[model samples]
Target: MAKAICILTGNHTAFGVVFFKSDANGCVTVKGEFTGLTPGKHGLHIHSFGDLTNGWISAGPHYNPNNEMHGAPQDEKRHAGDLGNVDVNEDGLAKLEMEIQHFHLTGIHSVIGRTLMIHQNEDDLGRAGNEESLATGNAGVGVAWGVIGICQSNISEKALEEKSNQ
Candidate 1:
């Protein structure tokens, strides 16, 4: 079965679909939609943990499956959840797409058990200088946040049985 998680942030929103090929193999694709942003760029990433109690606090640090410090998504020493920034037009809207590796839909490392966040500021790729810049400078507050979860499949068992009989 294919699964996905949808998240809505303050500045932008995203939908991620995860297809499992095996226990240890899978693909994650995400598309983001946003409007009414502050203009320029903003930091986007997946938090390590999920907060069922408080949506704001539930989002922990970046998803560092490798236990390394924070870095850009393309950086070799970066966290698994370090996706970098998203640019917003003058109208304050932006769209983005991404494909991720070393993440899963099920099991312990499953991204479905975490939170997605959109920050109000840009990420300097952890090189902004000073403690504030540590791990993208904490980038600004989370303007919007959402928990990840598997979407329900449209095809039901009954529907499949009928199609097979046909």
Candidate 2:
């Protein structure tokens, strides 16, 4: 399975981390934990570009290579990056885990080398019936963001080959 990680920061402060791995069936399992955010629900998504030097604005739109509409991860016609929302605790911490079968860490729909942003508001899953909602989910403000990158492995060469040979 392919694996990746994203370390997010907001307003120049340490924010959180997200770990991702692929299942044998090419689906993706995402596990994320965050701190130092407003206490409430926030939208999270993977953007088209990995560049975050400008607070992710340079990242462009969500990763929608398929030209789909904005919707939930399980929606039949949603951007590949639509991850719904994450709820933060009163103490400013949040944790979320989800399995998505529509996209992967590699290939044309790959989320690798993209930007993950945490918005200031919850995503309504494109049910708002507004133009902006269909484009941005009306998820106010981007408080934090990160770049998705490949995670290195610690396995030895011989062990790797032995497993492949099996």
C-alpha local distance difference test of each model? 0.66, 0.83
Pairs in steric clash, model 1: 10-144, 51-58, 132-137
lDDT by residue for model 2 over 44-78, one digit each (tens)?
Answer: 99889987667768888988888888998778899
Q: After superposition, how far is residue 71 of candidate 1 from its true place, in Å?
A: 0.9
TM-score (C-alpha) between model 2 and the true structure = 0.88
lDDT of 2 at 81: 90
The ten-residue window of minimal lDDT in model 2 covers: 156-165
Task: List model 1 lDDT by residue over 26-56, tens digit each.
Answer: 6665655666667888787778777736655
Residue 31 CA displacement from its true place in model 2, Å: 0.3
Error of 1 at 39 (Å): 0.7
Error of 2 at 130 (Å): 0.6
Clash count, predicted structure 1: 3
- Each candidate's clash count: 3, 0
